[model samples]
Target chain A: MNRVFITGMGVISAIGNSVAENQLGLLHGTCGITKGTRLSTRYSGLLPFGEIAANDEALKEILSVTDPGVTRTTLLALHACKEAIADAGLTGAQLLSPDTAFIGATTVGGMCLMDELYNDANNPANNSAFAPFYDCASVNMYLQKYYRLSGIVNTINTACSSSANAIMYGARLLRNGLANRVIVGGVDSLSRFTINGFNALHILSDEHCAPFDKDRKGLNLGEGAAFLVLEKEADTNGKKVYAALSGYCNSNDAYHPSSLSENGDGPFLAMNGALKMAGLGSTEIDFINAHGTGTENNDEVESRAMIRLFEEPPAFASTKSNTGHTLGASGAIEAVYSVLNLVNQEVYPALHFKEPILATRLTPVQVHTKKQVRHVMSNSFGFGGNCSSLIFSKAG
Target chain B: MFFIHQTSCISPQETFSNVKMDLLHVSVHNKLLAIEPAYTGVAVGVLRRMGKASRIGMGTAMRLIQEGAAPDGLIIGTANGGMEESIRFLKQIIEYHEDMLAPGSFVQSTANAIATQLSMLTKNKGYNITHVHKGLAFENAVIDTAMLLMENPGNTYLLGGVDEIASYNYIIEHTAGWYKKEYTSNQDLYKRNSAGTIAGEGAAMFLVNNKKEQAIAELTALTTLHSTDKELISGQLKAFLKKNVPSGESINLFLTGENGDARDADLVASCESAFGNETTVARFKHMCGEYPTASAFALWLACYLPIDQPLPEHMLKKQGTTNKNRTVLIYNYHKNVQHSFMLVTKFK
Candidate 1:
């Protein structure tokens, strides 16, 4: 089996529009969660969000997107993917090679245009221009077509863990000799569809999320896109290797559709399985990027899972405090952050964490500290008990 | 190669168990909705509220378990999952102005709801995932299942594909000319050289493992292509067959996806020509209608067909009697964009 390495990474979240900008925010401990100004929804002014600073028109202008009915989801995905491709120095020929594949994940999909879809669905006479881009596969299909990619292409939608599973699937493809390299990641643009959907569940935080904090209320919905160029070690000889993707595992809780078990059985098994796959002991992990959606159930459950996994749980933090919950994009976005931690040998503070949860009595990394970070384990648990843990180690 | 230990389906045809191929008849309809099976072992309260996709998916899993197929993992593919609930939630949000709305529809609107529901019901919490690519969704899940079996040689996987026709999505597709202007009976689906094919929905589940013992069929090869050029797809399929099949081995049964759309006639014919003239060729979309994951239905049919018996008369596009029906090759394309090929053989 061939080892997989991250040759390039790109992200555009509420924190920043590029990798450098995002790294700066992380280093400076600048939280991106704020009152929404870009998204046009009833709750835009009522609730907090990690809304990208630029509006749709501005994003289109920057990306040179001229397609009339293109959803913002596609634009954000294109922006991040373009940077990742450029950063990896992948030419059009490399992208078009049948050896390279694209795996995209998304929860919102074309519902980014929720109002328009509703209108078109209700009116028969209206020619639905966006109909072609509404399916979960549409974003990846658009990317494949845009790049003229002739390789294996697919999309995964495991909700919050969608992108994490995308990364795992890509690695397996490379290891199995199905593809030489894979551009794997996810994108989700905030829309009324998810906003109202999450609102109905009463998990949307009225204030900025406080992950792992005692008084944490709920999660704030965010939108962004992140992509990582994963190449087998043999193919990435001369490339700039960000980190080696050493381990990944996907386990289901089988307890509930939207909630984890009281014992965090899914999370514990996922983290434990990933460690076993990497052939590493629990203590070998230097840091952890917790899923920590800031909801009462997630924070507490994740905390308990950590305490169950390690003799002394490694220093951990939740960047959802920085970017809100990007939903489908959270896994990849946090993955990029986890890789950054290994590359920089630094850890960022979880934003609004005041006190540790009473049950686990675990306090997250509260200050930006330069540490000897080696192997960083990133956890992403989604609705439907889909729990995944990915371990990224320093590339030697 | 992965062995199909068991199969279940809730489709337009009565294919859930012991499919009577001889008694089957051609049906007529634009919307080929699945003929739901009895939820014999399912809880009544949960069955009352489950969506069509979930009911059929969970029902098939329950049936397999009762027959002694204990899958350690669950994976599924759907082009549009829980779309009915998604539309309902959106409509409610619009009507209520996003206030005091129920959470049930919203919770079920996610694409992975069916797979998660199966996990919750079965408590088989090993590896779970959902693939939502359009035409290749089911194929992607199949690919994952193959990899998982190779990685852990002893494990069994419950793999499935599911999709349902929701009015909101159906209307949007209809307005976009994705369906025939006139209602064409599925029995007459190929008889007419029309603009569009009928819309259909179904769920097909399989218990697959690496062990060949007691296996019904073996999946030898699977490939997906993303291209609009028919020539390119044909060349790729030829190459795929050359790489996977041994020399001089003949394909006995060739299943083709011809959804009765006039524009796809040339492409469909071109793909069919990739096989030898002696290979028995048949089409399936007429029976199941046309949906993204309808190829799952094709696969289910491939496993159930007897090696010695001839295919039902209505399903034959071209009949050849030279070879026993030991090998089945399924070729399907969606809207001339995504195409896939699968090779399945009777397990020795």
Candidate 2:
């Protein structure tokens, strides 16, 4: 059996721009959710969000991206992917090899330029350059082209759980002997299309989101990207191994399009399936990065699912409480965070939680604590009942 | 090995449960729209809210259900997923200034909406994923289905690829020089010798598992190339064939996804020439037109085409009369960029 290990990780979220910065913020218990100052949405000032500090122009300039009509989604993805590739010390030859694969996930592909798409669609002379970048796979396609990657390139869009599935799929590619290395992650930018869409769903919080709280209102929409370089253990002879991607599973709730079942069947099945794949017992999982979208339904249902799984549910926290819900990027972002927990043998606390949901009455880790973290689980459930769980273990 | 137990397609032709021939030579006016089924099994209220892709996808699912199949998982592929609803929602956001917007179009506009709808309708709580790559979308879904079924040998997965053409999407692609300048009948798609191809839309689904019993066909080999260099692709295809097909064994039928675009002729020719002249070659894009997942229609055709009968005159692109088509190879590429190959053989 092939053992998959995470060789490198890169992340840019509302809390920070790099893995080190995010770790610092997590240590200091900094909350990134605030009234948006960079995004151009009408609700930017009217509602709080986990908006990245940099604007699209600043990001493009920082990344030296001169491509015309490239969306912020692609820019963010390129930013993190570049970091992950560099951190892994992958050479141009290695990246260009047919043995390397790139799997990306994004919900807001080019819709980040929602106004532009509308204008071009309505204009009689629709010679829009952004038209090519409008599809969900355009972000990955751009990455593959920019990096000159020649391996199996594909995109998965299962809403919020998109990137987790990407990670799992990348691992499968290695285990199936189809690829030697894979760059897996996801990205999503703040777009009026998604903001208004999520707003219409009435799940946007006016204030900072409070995950697993009795008074939790809704989730704060966020924008970010994350990528991780994964390689088989046999190939990581002298490479810096961040963690081992031990197990992963994707399961559907099949109850609703935008909500989970009351029993949290999707969440349970995903977590349990992953554990079974890892050949680990429930008690072996030291900490969990809960999905905890701060939504009324999600928080409670996730709590019930956790209680049902673990006799004494492991120490868990919702990083979304800090970065807000990053949508498509949350799964990968949190996976990186979970790897951080295993690497540093510490756990970060969920922010803005005063009381647990009355029904399940579960409390997340409320303070940053150093612990003997070995195995960590991260959960991400998307609007389409697409739920996925990934478990990362400490590597020697 | 992955076995296709049952297959269903909602193509421009009458290719659903009844694979009737539409040999009228009727011309498609720049676009080939799928001839949708009645969908009488679904409720009127529910059907009213479903998008065109969802309707075709669910209609196929219903057909599979009638055939007594309850798949445990679903994996779907689409290039332009629910674009009709996405464009509508985007237009409304711009028109109404994002006020009083309903979530119906927004929910259905996602790339994974068709798969989500299928999962919700069938109450399938198993593995579900959606691939959105341009030309290799369905091919990637097929790969995922094979991987999943390989991991869980007994589990049956509903694998599908669906793409629909909308006015906004078509106009954008047309403006980008993806469609021919003059409106040509689909029947004359190959004869036009034009630089661009006709746009098309449809849905194709298959119940796939590891079991060979009662299977329609077995997917033996699959490979995708992401290069424009013909020599590189040729070398890779030779290696793939050498590994999958027996030594000195020739492929009986070669299905090519040539949609009458002159720019793609070189690559198409390169692909077909890989097989010898003794092999019978066929094309299906004229019937289904050209979309990202149009290769799926070709795949569906590969499963249903009669084994012993002579080739349909309209489907034959080149080569001799159809012999025993026990072994088939489906070769397709989109705009000379994403190339794919799939080898299908009889279950026996």
Candidate 3:
């Protein structure tokens, strides 16, 4: 079996615009959660979000995209994709290589352009530019067309676990000899559609979220994008390898639409399956990057699941406390964070935590501390009981 | 080879359960819907919250699983998912100015809902994924399933595609000239030259496994091309068939995606000469209508007609009916850009 290796990574989130800045923020326990400033929403002032401070115009200027019809989702995806390819030191020909696959995951593609969609849907004009950008695969298609990539290009939308599945799929392509290198990740931007959707579900937090805390209010919606360039171990002889993608698995709770079962069956199975694939035991998992959505249901259910799997449970923390729950981007974002954990030999603290949940009696790592991290399991659960767990190991 | 262990499809066609229908019954309106069954054993709480695609898709998936197809992974390719819910949510956004949007519609609006809903129903916590790439969506899922099966030989998958037509979207596509100007019944779709085909929606799922004992059909080859060059298309089609169907044994039947569109007519015209006069040629879109993932219905028909029963007289656009409909070739070219060729052979 071919071993999948993460050669390069790029991320743009509320906490930072690059992987270096995000690492600094994580080390200092800086929380990016705050009231929304850029989104044109009714609850922008009342609800807190991990919104990228830069506006759409700033992002466009940064990406040098002149296409006005390109949505923020596309812009964010472009930013991360460019950085990932650059970080991988991929040549121009490699970008257009048939052996290079690009898989992007997202729940909100051009749908983030909600206002434009409304006008186009009402009138049905053939000249409507927004119509072409409305499909969920629009952003990925834009990347493929601009780069002229002929490799296997795909888009995955399993809600929060979306990018995790994308990463897994990319690895499978490499394992199956379909591609030699895969640029796999996800991107989403703060928009009225996502905000309103989360608000309507009554899971939007008014203040900063505290994952696994007794008084955890709800999730603070965030927007960002992250991309990781994965190559097989054989292909990375001299290239800088960050970590090995040890194991990944996706599972569904089959319990509810918006919430998980009280027993946390989906999370448990995904985590267990990923570890089994990685050929590791619970005791071997040194640290866990818990999904920790900070919602009342997610924190309790996840904590109970952790307890069930890891008797005493490993030293785990939710970076959502630092970066806010990034929806579809959370999994890949956390995967990067877990890689950073193995590389830097440190554990980032979960912010705003005071007491443990009554049922599970589990508390996250309260403060930033140095640790000997080996295999880190990153969990991301999403709507419709979609749960995914990824295990990353230290590269030799 | 990836074999079809079991399958189910919810289409406007009279394919309820394992029953049979002899002929096509064209609907009065352009938009045709799947004749859904009464969903039983599903939790009422879950049912009420599901979008239309979720209900129909889960029902189809459950029926296949009941045939003892235990899938370790769920992969779905839905081009337009939960259209009604997305439309309602978008309308509310326009109506209420982005505030007070109903949570139900928003929850079900994501493209991932199709596969997630099925996984939730089965409680089979496995590899669940969804793809949305317009015309090439279902083919993408199938390609991925084949790759996954190749990587892990014994592993099976529930790979399928689902799409729905919402009224708002119907007006958008219909008014934009994606549908025909004249109201032609689906059965008579090919009689008149038109700009667009009638719109339809359906959900089709197949349990793809490596077990030859339970194989319904062998998915010999599935290839997707993104180029529009007709020369490349014909060349690739020949090479694809040569690899799967052999040189001497040409295709027994040609199940073409020949919707009423004139452009499509020009594309399918090559098949007439390419396969010679001995191959039976037919179309399934007349019954299911045209959509991005509409080729999925063609796959469902290929699963049945060649292996189980004969095609209806109305469906046989060209009569090259042979004694044994063993080698079935499914070809679809969408919007002149995406082309997919699938070769399915009867399991003997």
Candidate 4:
């Protein structure tokens, strides 16, 4: 089988603008959660979220977006894609190659634009300006158009596991000899829709989310975009290697629409499948990025799954405590954080970890610690019992 | 080579059980809507949180997996994943402008929610993927499943195609004038010379595996055509057939997509002329309202057509004298934009 390698990565989160900045934030244990400045929400004062400081116009300016009617989601995606392509050392001249493809994952594509259009439809004057963003057929179409790449372009929207799935699919396509180099990641912008959606489920935390803590409330809604340029291990450029995505598995809970199984069966199967694919055992894993959404059901269920899988669980923490849950972009953003952990040789603390859950007896690493981490397993489970786990190993 | 072991569809026509031509008996005046089974029986939480789209997706998914054990992979396709909830959430945004928007609807608005909900409902812990490619939404999903099977043999995968049309809002803007202005019945769909057909929604699921079975359809070959040129389409079909089928044997049945659109109808006519009298012809769009993965419903029809004794009158374009049902061809072209073709042969 062919080996897939991470050649380059680009991330735009609340923590920092570039991969280096994000790494610094992770190292210093700086939390990105803050009061909303861009999104005017009813819970702005009550809730802390991992929202990007820049507005849509600034993001468009950063990407040099000529089209005025581009969706905020698309702008964020293009901004990250531009950085990723450049970080991979494959820019304007290099992207002309036909062997490259772009695979993106987004939960809602151009939805913010749609919301604006719908709002403007009542007034005929604003309708003309919002017409360009009305095409919501496929989110990948916009990315393909912007990148001007003639290769196969696709998007996967499997909820929170979306970006992880995109990365997994990119690796598979490369292994299957479909493309030589591929850009894979996810992007989502904070919308009233998602903020209120998590709120409706009563899973949105008004205060700073406490993952794996006894007094945990719920998740904080965040939004951003992240991408990784994946290439064959043998064809790596001169850039510093972060980590290689070794194994990935996606599964459905089939238990309920909104809740996971009590035994964490879905997550267990996904983690086991990923481990088996990577040819690693429970003892081989050094660190785990748990999908601790700070929700009562998710933390407990994930802890139970961990206990059932390993005799001595690996050092693990839910970065959601620091970055908040970015929904569709959570998987890719967390994967980037996992790669940073492996590259930096450190385990970032799971913010606000208190006593272990009474039922599972699992406690996450609460403080930042330097360690000889080799392999890191990241988990992203979303609504609809869609559980996905990706195992990333340091490139030796 | 993932063989479609079992397939089931709950559409407007009587397509769930033994397939025959009972679709013509469906009143043309009355819009042919799916005779939905009780959602509470299939979905555990249908009583509390069942939305229109989730209910349809979960219902069809459960029916597809009912006969066998849970699949190792689950993939779903939907153009608008949860537009019903999305529109609802959008309405909340409009009503409240920006304050106190309902989060439940917002979360469900993501296109991948259907797959997520299905996974949660089924507790399936395998490869879960969802694709939305306009008209080729389901076909892309089928292609993905095939690719996965090629890589991992002996693995079972559940592939489902589902979409729902909310009463107003998003559909009006997204689809525009795709549905008839006046409520035209399903029976009149073929007779009425309209630019678009009546808008409808449904969900269909198929359990496919690499293992051969007595009652199965070997999905031998699948291809897609981006262009609408009839000559190019014919050439692609001939090349695909030559690669998959025996040299001299002709396709037993050629199922063509015959939506009410004139251009699509012409394309189907060209296909019928290409096959001539050597193959039987059938059409399915009139039965199931036009949607992206309506081809999935057609594939379901092809799976049961051979086993069922009598053919339904509504589906028959040209009745064949021969009774041999060995191979079936499915060709679907959506709005002269996206074209997909599949070959399914009865397993010995």
Query: Stretches of candidate 1 above 4 Å error?
Result: B23-29
The prediction achieving the highest lDDT against the true structure is: 1
True contacts kept of 4: 0.57
TM-score of each: 0.98, 0.97, 0.94, 0.86
Candidate lDDT values, in order: 0.88, 0.87, 0.83, 0.75
| Residue-level lDDT for A24 in candidate 4 | 84
| Runs with alpha carbons beyond 4 Å of true place in candidate 2 | A124-126, B22-27
Best by TM-score: 1
What is model 1's interface RMSD? 0.9
lDDT of 2 at A24: 94
Task: List each model's interface RMSD.
Answer: 0.9, 1.2, 1.9, 3.5
Cα lDDT of model 3 by residue, A1-396, tens digit: 779999999998888999998999999998998985576778878889898888889988998989757888888888888888899998889888878888889888888877777777677754466666766788888898788786788888888898998898899889888899999999887778778888888888898998999988899988899999999999999999999999987788978778999989999999998999999989999999999989999999998898889888999999999888888788888988999999999999999999999989998998889989999999989887888899999988
Model 1 misses residue B136 by how many Å? Answer: 0.7
Say which docking band candidate 4 falls in.
Answer: acceptable
Provide a comma-separated list of chain B TM-scores, one per candidate.
0.96, 0.96, 0.94, 0.90
DockQ of each: 0.83, 0.75, 0.62, 0.38
Cα lDDT, model 1, residue B250: 74
Candidate achieving higher TM-score, 2 or 3: 2
| Model 1 Cα lDDT, one tens digit per residue, B120-143 | 888877999999998999999999
Clashes of 3: 1
Candidate 4 lands at a TM-score of: 0.86
- Pairs that collide in candidate 3 are A254-B120
Residue A192 Cα positional deviation in candidate 4, in Å, after optimal superposition: 0.6
